[model samples]
Target: MSDPIVPPILPREFGVYFALLEVSALVQHGVEGQLRRDGGLSFVQFQILAILGEDPSSPRSMTDLADRLVHSRSGLTYQVDRLEQAGLVARVPSEQDERGVNVTLTPTGAAVLARVLPGHADEVREVIVDALDGADRDELTRLLRQVARHLRSRPPRSARRAPTRSAEA
Candidate 1:
């Protein structure tokens, strides 16, 4: 057999970039099954529920959800459509804007969220969180926040500090 191919040199920073990509992919893959089995949810669908769960009482506009999710409006709509069909969520007219629609978690949605969150937490701990000590995890979060802020991928207007939730939550 021919000798193994050697890759070209890349900037040192590329290591962090590639690591982030690999870890994200692995973590998502690790949790995908649990989310599906426990909540009958796709990752994006779970994300929608989780976001709404952050403030279940308040409604979030479709546009806001799409932006925050970094997903296309149509894709988000499809996911929302699925959730709505399952009776996990509802779309109501926005009181502030006659034409705008807001998404809210139904009681079923909240119950599903509560049901799945504990297992999700455990899955995350197994796949990623437990790999690091507490300080290291904090550092990782800080670095990611810095990168996110630099990229402006997260818009402040659509971002709110989520309260810390217990595992039971």
Candidate 2:
């Protein structure tokens, strides 16, 4: 419930933005070392696995993954390539769309996910969860989910139309 020491000129929304960014950066930095030590995975790679692991029986298309991650398809492809090389994920032709590719966590990927999850949970708990009381955590989660819902309702930055020149500029 306490506010971060945000600059006066930045205003309330900016304070929330900076605070969220700061917290995420810290949590990510805290786990970066552990993730490397345990799974030899980068944060994005872990995010990809974590997403796929959410429903191993279901597969996510590369385009779906790209939009979900707010990443470029090529960037995601490179990471998928690396994961593919590591035997962590498999890219199969989409049954619904032949040109589309679906990404799934392999058994090895699932095993790796299971192996790293405990430490990941512990690290997340220590860095972020432990910072708030139960009620505060609940409120935070609710507020974040609300904000996420609002944000997700909008089209992705890339999909939005760019403003056109008025010619009078």
Indicate the residue-level lDDT of 78 in model 1. Answer: 100
Per-residue lDDT tens digits of candidate 2, residues 141-162?
9999999889989987447667
Question: Per-candidate TM vs. native?
Answer: 0.83, 0.85
TM-score of candidate 1 on Cα atoms, chains taken together: 0.83
lDDT of 1 by residue, 120-166 (tens): 99999899888999999999999999987787754543354457999
TM-score of predicted structure 2? 0.85
Residue 165 of model 1 has an lDDT of: 94
The true-versus-predicted C-alpha distance at residue 53 of model 1, in Å, is 1.0
Best by lDDT: 1
User: Clashing residue pairs, candidate 1?
Assistant: none
Q: How many clashing residue pairs appear in each of the predictions shown?
A: 0, 0
lDDT of 2 at 166: 97
